[model samples]
Target chain A: MSEGPGAKVYVFDAYGTLFDVHSAVARHRETIGPSADRLSELWRTKQLEYSWVRSLAGRYRDFWSLTEDALDFAAAKIGGIAPEARATLLDAYRALDAYPEIREVLGELKAQGASIAILSNGSPAMLDAGVSAAGIGDLLDDVLSVDELEVFKTDPRTYALVTRRFGVTAEDVSFQSSNRWDIAGAKAFGFRCAWINRAGAPDEYAELTPDRTLCDLRGLLDASE
Target chain B: MSEGPGAKVYVFDAYGTLFDVHSAVARHRETIGPSADRLSELWRTKQLEYSWVRSLAGRYRDFWSLTEDALDFAAAKIGGIAPEARATLLDAYRALDAYPEIREVLGELKAQGASIAILSNGSPAMLDAGVSAAGIGDLLDDVLSVDELEVFKTDPRTYALVTRRFGVTAEDVSFQSSNRWDIAGAKAFGFRCAWINRAGAPDEYAELTPDRTLCDLRGLLDASE
Candidate 1:
């Protein structure tokens, strides 16, 4: 086994990081017509918005429920979706396509004696289905969900789950996320953070900076060396 | 003086509820081209998103800074904005137009011997600017902001400011907001919430229902009687 980097555990965020959140809507692009992309964008945006709103309101709803609520809102905004189509989209979400590099990257990290896991806002069942469908289940050491704590990400308690689960301090883990806000939260919580900027999004959260800003997960392997 | 309803205090949310948040972009519509409406929508969406994210992360930046950051994000998305135009937009935000009915509604409520105050996510300075610009400063009994607590709205503590300031319970105050999420939060916190559904948007936060859903601020006067 290759020597691991300073980080004993590499915790990844699931949606957008490993799984393509838009893949579900993309699969239904034919039926959704020209508004498919807009629908997907709105769906994801509202999904995260609801999570943060509920988290701040101290009202905990599972990610799946939030996902449904967001989908409904998106559908309404895009002029209504059929109930059957909505169901199909939600089903597609459970088995979203994993980013092409995810399997190979996770394999490389696992072979290097690194403990890989997912810390996501997805419900436990949702994460399980995603991992199983993506066929990355065996490669991960653990799959942690916010459902365990009854709060969403960016919450310190949500990040603390990693430390508690691995019996490691925040510094011992490298938290990776595709979201700038997630990276900001992880860095603020004292975790070594790697921001996967696949879309080259503009910088935000002026006060916090990630340990590494990578184009994709393949860079995680290079960071180890 | 008109007799009050079950609620003792009329607590208004300054942005959107009283002030026209989109008026800033509407003012710059000619310069912004056809993307003006999109930019305004994005700016407002990101502004609230940043607040919720920051609040969940337990990192509090004042609302003005968040507003600027949000505007920058919106500008970037709409294919870059001129620094001068960006400045103009930000300046416009400080003195956003108050809704047409605000003066009359607040006056009607205040004249009826109801305690009228603002409970908003805006910073004290921002709220002061908005209230002053709207020329309704004399009608308010008090203006409360999350800046004092260093957290944004939807936080129980943020909502608690109303109770503590007025020496009243949640049920004794009628909290009003144009944002459905804000209404959900205020209602969840046990306040008598009036959702100012100006756009007649679809319902959200399925579990919590507001005490009143009004098309405009004029309805507040009717609800009081």
Candidate 2:
């Protein structure tokens, strides 16, 4: 809550925050069995871990490649996953389901004349496919990716994309994400931030506190008030 | 394996590579019950996670504060920890036991005219305390901490401390760590890298492979030969 106020533009992270990344694994519960939930957790954990590590190391790889690499690690950890099932899961990731309340929340903000866009670690193609699948691409004014900068979110450079795109200072933009790390990153980069703590998880980043924290994106629009 | 060969100076990560981070919990196993091992694993995981997130977010808390913060997270997850036991664990961490072969391996490297140093995320006080307690403080020519740069390892600035201290290029240093993420960072920073796979863990960094992968520090002295 260190920042001054809300912002003119509203930027958000794509995966997990807007889209249900685990929905891909949930769709194949029949073949995956009891380990399905664990697989999903492992996949998502490795995905973010790889991104952070890669970003810190200055070794840039496309998000899709990292996605496949994470899947391989998860599959190996949760016992051997069949190639066919793996392929299906990978395909499903390209079109992850949007969270139930995203459209309503985005629509409310847009009506208030706030600029809306996705600033994500997702590549151009991945973010495009996700927005298209969710049928909410039209709701967003822009879809920005870190691929242009050859880095990932949490890097100040990646957060700079939002300001660079619309010619706004970080204070003029409110960044939102379900990931605690992303919220910390945005807040540290000088943006007003809202942490969507979907699961009511405890805050892990002890140093950086978000401007606002809510149980869902539904609270985000109300926070601007 | 991307580098040409071994390096002039041998730099290492302190926590898991040279010191047994789990020794704190191992000392309290009787009190901790079956959850002792799980607590250790969770503590170590959260400790590293907090450091990475904090570094990427640019919040810059020292490693000691991050360690205590991570311990709080681990304690909350594993029900709760008693204050007396917590005090004991924290004290044990200051003097965590070094690996059995550390002295022998370090001696062999020192005999061959290698420059020995530790470049760790630990604070100056923490690294000095650990090194003194382990009785090998004299074996190292330098003890570098990220506190100088106010950042964590894997940040190129932290790595630059080694080069700046020795007036050598990254190619002149061979960095070793039990943490795969650390290895990726050193390698990406252009140092010849050695991954001490102490636990036989799978390689998580799919993008950059280490120049040398050893079961322990035993293979390292010979690898340079």
Candidate 3:
């Protein structure tokens, strides 16, 4: 029941942590058929894989293009998707459904005199559309994208953006990411990290451990206290 | 019927290219139950994922440890693996089976006076054991490990090691890998790349296409022509 470690800035990972990435596929479940979930999972997997591979290769492509490329791969694996349906899926991605508690949590965080922002691999335009559609744009003070540095998450430079933008040391920032790899990168970079483990997935990155593991953003409010 | 692109040196990726990465799990199929193949697939996926993430985060762990970490993840996901069984799997990995055509193809390439080597994300010890077990050490001009650079493949630096070691330009090297991403990296780095598409999985990284796509190493012989 004690108060958690206080951080000067709370930076949340945009996709999966705030907006539900799978919602785009869910919206067109009928069109995708029984393999919809499988398609969505593959799409998400390839998106991250492409990001990491591209980052390591120093081939910087915007996340939007990467998202389309991932969708193409997933669609191919799951069977051909109609061009119209694929377009619909991509459009749906532009305004993905935010998690149920996103608005309430961001409102609470803002009311608590804490600085909040998003640090994401999403391109600026994608993040802008999603944040505005999710109606949390007013709650967040800044939305940082990797497109600025032409790299993706898990890169030290990507994590450095949060510290650089907010003008705070990594120790003064609490980084929250639903992606364990992102958590590992941020934690390794010296941020007080919280892993938003919504799926109860198994642990990874044996050497670097997150500062806290939370099931949802509600747990973040406690950290601010 | 026609000679393919000739290069000064022929470089290959180690795991999945020369050796069978899943052969280790095949050795312990009964212990793993029906999920043996699943476990192996997940293990390979996580192994590569860990490598990419670690490389991006600038946190380098030897491929051997990462291999173990990946196995642990796959085992935990599929269910608890007995400690002794786990150790057995790890031992099996140290000397994975070389692909049936590895010897013949490497011999042919070397016979034609091509300088052939391995440029891999594997640690020195892992590559050493696998090459010795496969009995292809004499056929190789050198075996390069990312351990020296402390970064995994897809990083241009990993590919650069080949050019540096052989004292050849990237254009003077022919890099082959069963991994599409590795091929993409090699191609982007200016190597005459060949994708050993053993699985015939969907193409990715749309812009950076390999110079050739071959089903096996036998096709590599044609390139040496």
**DockQ for each numbered candidate:** 0.74, 0.49, 0.78
Fraction of native contacts (fnat) of each candidate: 0.62, 0.41, 0.81
* Over 4 Å off, model 3: A1-7, A223-225, B1-7, B223-225
Tens digit of per-residue lDDT, candidate 2, span A70-118: 9998888888688899999999999998999999999998888788999
lDDT for position B175 in model 1: 87
Chain A alone, TM-score per model: 0.96, 0.94, 0.95
Q: What lDDT does candidate 3 reach at residue A110?
A: 76
The residue pairs found clashing in candidate 3 are none
lDDT of 1: 0.90
Candidate 1 residue lDDT tens string, A142-194: 89998978889889999999888888889888899999989988988999999
TM-scores, all models, native as reference: 0.96, 0.90, 0.95
Error of 2 at A186 (Å): 1.2
Report the Cα lDDT for residue B78, model 1. Answer: 84
- Candidate 1 at B60: error in angstroms? 0.6
DockQ comparison, 1 vs 2, better candidate? 1
Best-to-worst order by DockQ is 3, 1, 2
Which candidate's TM-score is highest? 1
CAPRI quality band, candidate 3: medium
